[model samples]
Target: MQKLLASCIFFMLLAFGSCTQESDTPILVSTEDLLFVGGDKVRISGRLLTNQDVLATDHGFLFSTESSFAGAQTLSLGQKNGPGRFIGESTGFKIGQTYFAKAFAEINGQRIEGDVVELKTLTPSVSSFTPTYASAGNEMVIQGKNFPQGTKVFFGTQEAQVLQNLFESKLTIRIPVAAGQVVVPVKLVIQDKEIVLPQPFEYQAGKYTKVSEFPAQARIYDNTFFTNSSGFHVGLGRLRLSDSYRSFQRFDPTNGTWTEINFPGNPRRFAFASSSYLGGGALEVDRDVFQFDRSFYKINGSSFERLPDLPFNTREAMAVDWNGKLFLFGGRDGAGSVVREYDAIGRTWSQKRPAPFDMSGTTAVFKYGERIYVLAASGQVWEYLPSQDSWLTRGTYPGNTGQGFPFAQVIGKKAYLGLYRRTQEIWELDLETGVWKSKNQIIGLPQSINAGHFQSNGMIYILRSAEESTNGVLPMELYKFEPDAI
Candidate 1:
């Protein structure tokens, strides 16, 4: 009996040892992916069981340049739950974008990946809005809300003169003063359809209320945002990769306009191999190098040049700047990974705390004083301490919105993000507290495939596919999200 038991134990140990490997090949989890929406943080949960000490990629977004909040995409491992269940959250999603996720698990140096999951990005806001003080019809300058530039606002039965627009959401105009209560119902006309605001205002007072006294049709949430999608003060907002193609634009909420910038030669600038060039001022400036090269690079306006690269090749990794050194995970594509380092000034790569899993496309956002948040593709979320390059998996992407926001671009102390494949929408993740609170969604372009490259300079642009289906052909016209006031 003792001999038989020993044989069984030996077999079990061998089996578990063989399963602990890493893999870069994608998993095929269905595309019913999770979707994160609203200004509230959501959750995603799952399960995993393995007798091996395996590490692998789970979920995250890639195509860095396309994401308005593009940072590092992520990879994740399942957490222990209910003997089998695991959970996660897509904490830093950008609005108006779509995304897909996957998972991998390994035991004893043998790795296996999960399937892919896909989901659509949601509109920045559910409705368009306008604020006016004019009574029924005369003519009122209806300050637009939740509006993309070029959006038309109406004053009841009469079309108000759109004198000027500030930010895609703010507008100024004179009500026709047709002669009534000086108050009126405002509506937004889009696609030839009329949407009356739920809240009404009175122009009688001869003043406009931007946030308060909004009509029923006004978009309720109004988180401030700037061009960077990270508005602690500059209106930094949740940055969403508006298009799959390369393009840059900014929406000025102060003046409704969609400003455009020349496309960058480095379209996928957010790749793990490219993290070194985030600039010396960035929060994750790696002091130590990884697998790429010892030199790093930077995004100078709209170009890329030779800089330091990590000594090792990495994928779906997380990063942070500590004592001027970039502490990072040398995640494996699938062959079990390591945690490498890079020196910015010295221009060299070194070693540090290795990651718990082989990861890629993970997001690094911070709550400033509290901690730096790390999210992964496999729905793994954790906080990293620069003092110790270690990780503690918090949870999974909130909800099954496979289309969760994956970028976390900071503006001052605030962090903003954009969801994949979404037309116009952003989410704000406060870095001071590690909690998520969303604001108003932007109304930019319509959701389409490969929409990571869409950028806005106060003016949002949407290009219809000229090669989609038979009757789906549309012109690649530049539709100004919201033109600026002149």
Candidate 2:
């Protein structure tokens, strides 16, 4: 009986010691509140409560989108030799998402998880937007989420007028007139936090205003008009049956008068002319048939001097002056789609890449900044980079392609296109944004299809051409277009 009593006492003491050892294990005690919650990050804090005898290999916070700890993301505060308080942090959390977190500890090859804490992240994002190009007083809608009340919007440095119907997901603001043509960031300030959009917004720069009429000249079509450093020149087109003009005229904007000059060349038709002295003289004897001018010329003083011939003969070709060289685009040499570059400095001709599509008919070529743009008869717009020798199809022309002849001239990053069919409604294209807007119309302008057009300074000069009249009598008129006059 004494032996039995001794064994029972020993077993009870062993059991009590085991209970004490298990109770001394590390425990996770979380703080009542989170440290911080903003942006896409969160800060959590907690304490590991235990005696100095227990070891905590690792202590941190476990977070997850779900309430359970399975597949939760772990953020380690660090290893602790004994019980102590710890602060943990995590980033890259999704905006506007709710998350659950708990303090965790690894003790003696076993995991101990603390009580769960709910956390919701603050997310601000813009899903989609519209009206990348807008004039002042135009309403623009920005679609997003988490926009606080009393949010402020700005285009560049100009503050836009926010409308009354502003909501958390949608904002309506009027564009400010002070906006410039430059590509600028759109800023949205919500709750003292500023968010800038990835894509930039552009302000329309140009508007049309009718100026003085062109001094009297033979109303003719299919003529070549070019602008040089000296002044504007107009010449060479069908005046009547079996008759074409061999005379060239110079017009000084200051004097506003056309002075006839001697031009030595055969009566050419559908010839291309550039801003400088280089001009293409037609070699085709017949206008109705497919006859292209393989030869080109340069105007020296009052005379036309012939230059080296092109690789292929083409008529109605589009050409532009880029960096002291002439870039010739598609025209008709049996449906010509060829592109050639003529370097006046080297006096050599080399072929570049062809147009994206055939430019057989009347094509308008203009230069905006460093890039050369071509508007084909098919209403396709293309931009050419001279340095890279590359071509990019910007977009299709949003106007009537069937109109007699399309006119385009670039003024300060804006291309003014006009003379569409019989309508004098001019359209302005934001070259930076590729957005088109209709401007003021040119009233009292004739319905002539083929007018000679050129741009100098801020003025666009249109030389009136003879219409398809039964008696072959056309008015000789010229008009000047000013963009900012309005």
The sequence of per-residue lDDT tens digits that candidate 2 reaches over residues 38-145 is 545688777665444567788888889998767889898667777666787787676577999888788877877666878898867788777886556788888887
lDDT per model vs. reference: 0.39, 0.69
Q: Tell me each candidate's TM-score.
A: 0.34, 0.55
* After superposition, candidate 1 runs with Cα above 4 Å error: 1-270, 273-309, 315-323, 327-332, 335-338, 362-371, 378-380, 393-405, 411-414, 417-427, 432-435, 438-486
Per-residue CA lDDT of candidate 1, range 1-486, in tens? 322443355456556556655343222221122434321222443333333333433332222223242553554543322213344554444434465454334333454433444444333232434333323333334443444444565555656677666543455655554333334566666433466777764542211112111111111110111123421111111123222223343333344344444432333323332222332111112454332323344434333366644444443354555455655543434423455556768777776565575543433333344355555544456666655656676554442223432444454554444433332333444555656443333332244322111224433332222213223323222222231111
lDDT of 2 at 2: 28
Where's the lowest-lDDT run of ten residues in candidate 2?
A: 208-217
**Residue 427 in candidate 2 has what lDDT?**
73
* Candidate 1: 10-residue stretch with minimal lDDT: 230-239
Cα misplacement distance, residue 188 of candidate 2 (Å) = 24
* Residue 37 error, candidate 2, Å: 41
After superposition, the stretches of candidate 2 with alpha carbons farther than 4 Å from their true spots are 1-217, 277-287, 290-294, 300-303, 470-474
lDDT of 2 at 162: 82
Error of 1 at 231 (Å): 15
| Model 1 C-alpha RMSD to native | 34.4
